[model samples]
Target: MAFVIHMPLTNTKAATRYAAELPMRETSPGHYEGYYTATSNVRATGATVEVRAQDDYGNTASEIAKGKLNIN
Candidate 1:
């Protein structure tokens, strides 16, 4: 099973603690793909974006992605 995940932005400031609410859509069995528009403006800094996936069987998986938001 493959899932296509899309994030609006992959950069955030160290002082910013914003949530990236992504609306996920199931494209196939055990697969999902969706894109989320950034609701908040993140400051220019280095930060880590964490992504988690939950299955119907209560199984959870997570991945850490790096982001660097430029603060104007």
Candidate 2:
């Protein structure tokens, strides 16, 4: 089965290192919901937050969601 997940932007800042541990919770069969803090600092003016997921069988998936913070 394929795993589905989503993360809404919780917070954001400019050029600062955003720190937050992703809290992934199993919501349903092959589905999860949580958030992961991006460890990398924002380098440019426009960049989206990306997340990756992997299953026990080594299957992997990724998605790029809108980041909550913006650097001016």
Candidate 3:
């Protein structure tokens, strides 16, 4: 499983494939954590957060929390 956060730009799409991606570490079974440095180039309110989870069988599921992020 993987967790990712997309920087919210007012004009950018929620699921941008070219945006900066965070690498996740599996702390425990079915648990994950990811960290990224905040840069002056990216900041917004009501941003988009995307999570992509996968199983041992390579089955992947993706979920998006749109317009629910606030970055400073």
lDDT of each: 0.50, 0.48, 0.66
Q: lDDT tens digits, residues 5-35, model 3?
A: 6553233466455555566788998678877
User: What are the models' TM-scores?
Assistant: 0.41, 0.36, 0.63
Model 1, total clashes: 3
> For this target, which candidate reaches the highest lDDT against the unseen true structure?
3
TM-score, model 2 to reference: 0.36
User: Between 2 and 3, whose lDDT is larger?
Assistant: 3
Kindly give the stretch of ten consecutive residues in candidate 1 with the minimal lDDT sum.
1-10
The reply for model 2, stretches above 4 Å from the true place, is 1-43, 67-69
lDDT for each residue of candidate 2 in 11-54, tens digit (9 for 90 to 100): 45542243333556778986767643433552334545555677
Model 2: how large is the Cα RMSD against the reference?
8.3
What is the RMSD, in Å, between candidate 3 and the native fold over all Cα?
4.8
Looking at model 3, report the run of 10 residues with the lowest lDDT sum: 8-17
Model 3, residue 17: what's the lDDT? 50
